[model samples]
Each structure stands twice: as C-alpha cells, then as structure tokens.
Target: MSQELHPNGALNQANELSSMHGAELTERYNKSLLGVFGTPSRVLVRGAGCHVWDADGNRYLDLLGGIAVNTLGHANPLLTSVITSQLATLGHVSNFFSTPTQIALAEKLLEISAAPAGSKVFFTNSGTEANEAALKLTRRNVGTEQTPRTKVIALEHSFHGRTLGALSLTYKHKYREPFAPLPDNVSWIPAGDIQALREAVDETVAAVFIEPIQGEAGVRELETEYLRAAREITQAAGALLVFDEVQTGMGRTGQFFASAPVLPDVMTLAKGLGGGFPIGAMIVFGEENTSWLTPGDHGTTFGGNPVACAAGLAVIHTIENEKLLEHVRETGDWLRAALAELDGISAVRGRGLLTAFELQTAVAPKFVSAALDAGFIVNATDEHTIRLAPPLIITREQLETFLAAVPQLLTAAV
Candidate 1:
C-alpha cells in the first residue's frame, strides 16, 4: 500500500484510498462510456501545474502531461486568463465571418512552419481533423493520376489519429484491422529504412506522412540519413512529404516544427501547440500544395473557435518568452543519462523533451501502476516501454528526482 503526504506538516498516510471524491460518480460511466479506453484508474478532480489530485485526494506528479497536451502545465494562468478574457468578449462565430484570433493563429503557424511568405493554413480542432484536411489537400495535389492519385507511404508504427481518414494513415494493426477498408491507397515501409522508402515510393504515391520522431513506436527517431532519403524519394516521385508533428510540434522537440534540413510540403500540428486547448492546423507550403483546396473542399464547425486560437497564441508567446526550447534540450539530455543508470531499463531514444525508454522486461503496465504509487505518473507506450513527455515547464530538479527514483520503482514492478 502507498501513502499520501499530509497537506500542512509532514507524515504520509497509507493509500488505502477507500474512496476518491469522484470515484463513485465515475463508476456510472463504465459501459455507457464505451470500452475504447477501458475503465480509467482514478477519478481526477483538480489539477494545478504538473500535479493532479484524485477524487480520493491523492496527489500525483503527471509526467505524461495528458499525453503531452498540457505544454505550459495544467491550468496555466496565461492560458486560463486568455480564454476567460476571450470568452467574455467573443466565443464561437461561424467561419462565415473572420476573426482576428483565427487569422492571427493561422499566420503564426505559417511563420513557425517557416513556409514561404504566402503559405496558407487550415485550422481544425484536433490532430485527426488536421490530418483529414492534409489528406484532402494531398488528393487535390496528385490530381487523378493513372492510378487515380493512389498510394500513400507511411512509416510502420506511426499513429496519426482515429478518424477514418487519419486511421488509414495510422499503421496500428488493431486500429486498422477492425475498421477495415479505411480510405484506401495507403501502404507501409519500415520507419528508418531508406532502401524501403526508396523502393516503396514512386510516381504512384501521393504523399508520405511521417512523424519526425515516432512517439507511438516508443519514441523511435528517424535517423537523418533516413529523413534525407525520404525527402529525395518523395520529391522524385512527385509526392509531398508530410510531417505529422501532432506530438512533437510547438517546442516539444526543441523546434517549432520537427524536421531537419528539408522542409516538409505539409506539416500537421496539434497536442502541445494549443497548450491545453484543442486546436490543430495543416500547414501547406509552396503554391502547388497551398492551392489544394480553393473553396468548399472541406469544412468543419468549431474548427477555428476564437477561444482555441487565443489559447494557442498565448502558448506560443509563453514558449518564446520563457525560452522553453533550451530547457527541453538541457533537461532531456539529463533525463536520458540518468535513466541509463536506472535498473530494469534497456535503451532510451528521442529529442528535446520527447523521450522513451525500453525496460529489460515486458512489465511496463505493472511498472506504470507502481509509478503512480510512487507519486509519479507515466504512460507505457508498449508492454516493455515507458514514455516521458512531461510539460515543457517542468523544472530540472523535478525530473532529476523522478529519474533517481526510477530504479527503485522498477524494482517494485511485479
């Protein structure tokens, strides 16, 4: 059994956590909630900074940051203030009318993608929606080839999103198997295999959607040689190189957009980009890709809500003002080195604050539960791998403490 630290003085209490505040209330959602994610472990009630208190009043340090969504930390004042102020003034107005926040965010995204000055952007409310938009744009660019603009090359173990269109691009067998015949013309090649990419891609391909760093594949990073080869092959095939930065964008990987020397024709962003709000964008560079959809090609309600855009703007500004990129770079190196010393661990990979480590055994699910008992929270991407994508605002000291205790936590795993 674990214990909780008392609020005021010192003593920790046994985590006999009889009943969390919202535990009972959450029980009613079991079947009605759909078994997609299964029953959640705890009924969380409040969150501040990187800590969350469950219904039972147990506080835990959240290292996953809601799967890397809370970039500035939970309930960040800057984001909250901006949302409150914006909601007070203006909320959702249809796309029929243009709002400054929407336009401004679109322009800011273009600037960050480093696309040519006149690059265009389309905003959505989630990473999947952005991928949908990008897919449409790709179809438009290919324009009815002999194979009908057929064939898409995506890396193995890549996770784009859940929507039918996005799922077609996502390579998870389970997600794709059950939902068979997803928007077709998609194929897969090993993530870092240059030869595979070279052979798999050609004029028949429409686009190559890839994550600069594969978050779902346990933070498997694509080597530079691989990225370079992908660029060459995709270009030779006349296929657009699409970088899905849904998990690595907005300073998560120490870059506004995760890429190397070659700029992607299309970049899809979500997750940390909006700081805790839901907002996504599909960036199109060059006139050829920019003009994919002129009008009435695709549309969504609440895609560019002014409130969401405000949150995104504040997030980007905070990242710049606070210089979070440097923090991620330094802290990431420190965490990686420290984890190397932790027992039951094997290898670590990733960049900036996005990192994943493989344990020597396939007990990560047990390990993750034990981590919660130890006052820390993490997500296991695989049966043998744990991923760490803490909020970019986490201090060096916090990570050091977590890393130092990882060995002991691993020992506790059954």
Candidate 2:
C-alpha cells in the first residue's frame, strides 16, 4: 500500500526538501539538508546544448558544464536517445546476469585503453568508487592479503573525490582534515616534482596517484617530461603509476584520456565518460597487472547500468564519429588565446577543452558572479583562479560568444 504525491505539491515538497527557493523554503532546507554545500544556487529546471535555465527561466551559457561532466552539453540528443532505447530493451540486471551494453562498454573501454598487453576495466557508479577500486587493487599488488602494504603517494592540490579511500588520497586539507582517522599511509607530493616523487616512492609505497590536470586546485597540467620521469621512477621502484583521469579524460584534455608521454599502469575515469550519465571505470594494464583484483575483491551494483553503458558507448562513438578531438584541439587553442588577451588575467593554464586563467586581483568570486549576470556560467576556485571546462561539442561561434564576454566581466570588478 503506497500513495503517490502529485507534481503540484511535489514541487513544493522538493523545494522544502533541500532547495533554496524563497526564505521559507531556504529555512526548511537549512534545517534538514547537510550543511556541506551551505546554500543551493537557483534550481535549474531545464537545459539544452550549452545553456541551462533556472526555475525562473533565466538562461545561462553553462560554461562549467556541470563541473565538466556535461561534455556533450545538457540534454544531448545522443545521450537521451541511447538511454531511452537501452532502457526500453533492458535497464538493470544484477551481477548474476550479463547485458550486451555492459560487456560492450567494458570492451570499448579496453579498446581505448589499448596499452601494451591489453587492459581490463572494472565498473563503478562514480569517480570515487573507481578510485577506491583502484586503490584496493593496488593494495593487492603490494602482496599479502593479510598485512598488505599501506603507502600511497598523491599529488598536492589533487582532487580524487570525497569517499574514505579517495579522500585519503586527495591533497586538500579542508576536504580530509575533518575526517582525521582516514585509511592511512597516504603522502602528498608536489604536482610536478620528480625528485620529490622519487623520494616518496620507495618499496613500501603501493601506488602513486596523480591527475594530469589538477582540476580542483585551479587546473595544473602535469608536465609530460615529469610524467615520463614519474614512469621511470615508479617502474624502477616497482610501485604502480595510477592516473586519476576523473577530469581530464574522455577527450577533455584533447588527447583522449590525457594520453600522456608515459602510459599509467592503472587509469581511473569518470565525469565525461558517460557524457552526463554516471559511469566510472578503473582500467588495469596487461595480464600481469590486470588480474590484480580477482572476483570478490571489489564490485559495484549500478555501475554498469545498461543505460549508462549505452550512453557511454554513444559518447565514445560520438567522439570518434564526430571527430571531436580535432575540434577540441583547434577551439582550445583559440579559446586560450582569446582568454589570455583579456586585460588583468595574469596567466592562462591547461590544454585542450580543460583550461583556466589566473586573475591578477583577488576578487575571483565577484568575477564569477559578474559573469553569471552577463548570462555566462564560469567558476572561480580560489581568490585568483577561474576555471573553464565547457562542452567538447561547443562550436566556434559558441566559443566566440563566451570569449566576447570575458574582458567585460573580468575588468568590471575593479
């Protein structure tokens, strides 16, 4: 016996649940919702292409692209079509059964992985799980299921995610400080410091995790030379190099997985992997390392949701069929140029679709809000850094429109 709530009251109920609509609704949300994010921005009602409309129908350019997850933009027809067709065919079947979409996605991921000796993928629902699974597999590689090795070296300002294992690896103190007794033995190394990494990785360390672009710390691209150096260091020491491609993968960094100078032994991917749907994977290289986690070591239920896999398949196919990497390379060069030309923007960082600018002043929040007022969506991470990770499908005209608004918003603050 169950009762259905009408959409009329449902809207109000939703507002009461966690939305910051009006003073009354805001108060209700404050009382119940976790205070982590503090307050909600306007409720986004609909989205299309690179634009999103709030509940009040105010449209915005959506340059952040849902924190880089919406690589194909909001409500992409391809994502919608694949998800619909897959749902109609078969949606969810537990690990007891197999679906074509699930197996196909795994195979496609491996095809893209195409490293020496071939790789295998493990599915998860989010980047955090992908990282957690990767970390667990790393533990196994260190040998001894009993006292398993504990040390992991992560980069400073790197953001893996908020889960216990991933949080342990995240470099930011604020995200990890509150939870003091984390799953231990994690050390923070400077992003591009090869010697420091050399010191950090001894025989005791199980894995070394890094993000090619440290997205949360205002987009720091690890030098390819340093990456190659890390490879030599890790290989010599026998510690695995695990790349957390949660932000820069899936054609975002123009290389189609931040295809670095040195291939990592393990790569974790999410964000744009499913093109908007939630899907994450941990790819282990070759036979020797790919079998790190036997069955019963790690798993997820809704990770390979048929619809998500189909959406991922569509996303990968679209990236290849539509030839988006070329667009990203050319458009990214132009966007970086246009952004760097803006007065008072001190420096531009990142490559491909993932790019950012450092402000000469300390009013980045104001700049972000001003951009919103100008009908553009951009974010300022610290007092001096503005991040821009837009859709891979954004056109030259669309990028020009965004570029046209930068100088005004940036210089307007002062």
Candidate 3:
C-alpha cells in the first residue's frame, strides 16, 4: 500500500487535515453548505494585495477582486487596522443611538455623491438592503398624496439585489420567477434606448432605477445620454431616478459616484464601500425635506456599525491620500487598450477599474478556466464576455504580468 503524501511531502492524518487541499474542502462544502452558488471554482485559503492562494497552495492573480468588493485588495493593512481598532474600541451599537462613525461615513458618502446640503443617508448591511431602502424611500416620497405613485421602471439586463423588493426591481426573469408575486408594479425596458425610457417613465412611477454600469449584465454600460434622458423624464413626471451604483461606486469608476454625470436623485452603494468590510448606503439628494423618509419608516440594527464605518472611512482616506482614483484611471486605460489589442479580444468597454472584453470566439468560460489553470482569476459574465475588476490598488507591474499571459491563456481556450 502506498501512503498519500501531502503537497509538502509527509502525510500524517493530522498533517493531512491541517493541509487539506482545495478538493478536500470542496467535498466538505458539498455536504454542509447550501448549493445556491453551485460549485465554487476554488477553495481559496488566503489573499494579499491582488493575489490569492487556494488550499492547494497555488497562487493566482485575483482579477475579480471578490466580485468587486475588495477595493484595496485582500487583507489590506490600512483597512484591516481600522477594522481591528474599531472592533476593539466599539464594534457595534444598536440603531437606537447614533455613532460618530456612522455620521462621518454618511457625510463622506454625501460629499462623494456631490449631493445638496440637506441630503440624507440610510445605511444597510449589503447592496440588496441598500436597494431595499431605496425602494422604500421611493414609495415613501409620495407624501400623503391622493394617488400615490406605485410603479417602478428598471432597465432590462439590470441587477439590483436579491431581496424581495430589490428582486422586483431587478430585470432578470430567471431570478424573479422563482419568487413570484414580488412587490407589484415593476416594469423593464431595454437599456440605452432613450425612447423606451421616455415612454416607460410616467407620472404614475415612483422611481426609475438604473445601473450607471450594469456590472452583472456583462459589464454593460448605460450611455450618459440615456441617463440624462431618464433623469429629465423621471423628474418631469415627479419620479425619482435611482442609480444602483453598487458595483460602480467607491472609486471603481475613477469618479466617486458613477452617477456623477447624470446626478441621480437617489443612489445605492456597496461592494467596495468598506474595502472588503460589509457595508452599504443609500443617498437621497434633491430638495431637502422633499423626499426624506420619516423616522421609523426604514431602519437596520447593524447597518452602520462602528467597525464597518471605520473600515469605510479608511477605504476613502486611502483612496484620497494614496491617489488611487488617478491610479485607477491610468491603469484601467492601459489595461483596456492592452486587452483590445489582444489576439482573442474583439471589443473592450468600461470605466476606470471596472471593465469587460468581448472574445472573438464565444468561449469566455474556457478562457476563464485556462486563466485559472495559468494562476490568474477572471470572471466569465457570459459565454462571450469576460469581466475584469481587479483591485483598485492593483499595481502596474502586476497588470503587466497578466497582460503578458493573455495570448497564451486565450490560445489555450481557443
């Protein structure tokens, strides 16, 4: 009988369990965890900067950046310090009492939003919760009117979140049909069609939710002109324009808010807001008390926990002090140009660090698998589109490494 050897050589039972590889963890996961996400591609153990190591000790360049949640990359020192310190000092307080951390983060979000003076914020635990808040706020904005606005218009191929209310606003039928009877009066129109938007947004609508860049829908971008039209049409009809910036906010798009050009009346942000810590926020701008949600109308127990807020403040501070916005702009441009020139790439489009490319051959998953085998992480948004949202702090040298491997990776898939 042959003894099974560990990756490092010796294999005692204790050593084997201690050094459990990706396959072993995956098997355990199958028995104990829900299968909602299907089989995860890897059982990663640790991450640093733009790189992650799986249980098998294989290191891969992380281009997905925790699905765009890791703004400062994995295990960022500055963000970790803030989180640890805040947790040690004051980790969480119920919504009954306000904390400076919450107020400071809200003020920061408002500033980044470039909202008016009296603009207010509502915090949540995730993007879905933030969108939920937006939905409720939209409904509440119809202050004591004879006929309250009840309709919501969202763009087709858009993704808001998975909650009951947010799912109603989402455009994917597959995700919505399973949980039917979602909050009523939601309609969808093809994105980037100004005419469609003009027709759909009417006086009966409470809000029109749009993703400045539809990250999940293959990183599709809604044109600035289309957004402007939405704003104009929604405003004229007294409908609030809600921009779901969950994937595009927090310096992912160079600008602090992707809705900066269109200036949406309301915006929901999360993903990288806490630089890997979980936190989400909804900003309601426009005339001061015009759209404010009354107290007790919307609330969250752990929405603005001090630790998360501290982590968020650290993320913003690092972006400013380290000048990551400018870095994203420069690195993203170089990457887009490089990807466009790649042998298998057909088209490249996105803003700042959030980007995607169309493959000449419709085999994005194949390419993704090949990239993984070659020690790189990338996402296949669809059969033909591969999305890249590497950390905002990903360096030029690290990008060069991935760029150098592109042709071979694509060739393997081909």
Candidates, ranked, lDDT: 3, 1, 2
Judge candidate 2 at residue 33 and give its lDDT: 88
Which parts of model 2 have CA positions greater than 4 angstroms off? 1-32, 143-148
Cα distance off (Å), candidate 3, residue 184: 1.7
lDDT of 3 at 319: 92
Error of 2 at 105 (Å): 0.9
Indicate whether candidate 2 or candidate 3 has the larger lDDT. 3
TM accuracy, model 1 = 0.93
lDDT of model 2 at position 238: 77
Clashing pairs for predicted structure model 2, backbone only: none
TM-score of each: 0.93, 0.92, 0.93
lDDT score of model 1?
A: 0.85
Best by lDDT, which number?
A: 3
At residue 400, give the lDDT of candidate 1. Answer: 74
Q: By TM-score, how accurate is candidate 3? A: 0.93
Q: Write the per-residue lDDT of candidate 3 for residues 276-320, one digit (tens) a residue.
A: 889999888866533568867878999999998998999999999
Root-mean-square deviation (CA) per prediction: 6.5, 3.2, 5.2
- Could you tell me the lDDT of residue 322 within candidate 1? 91
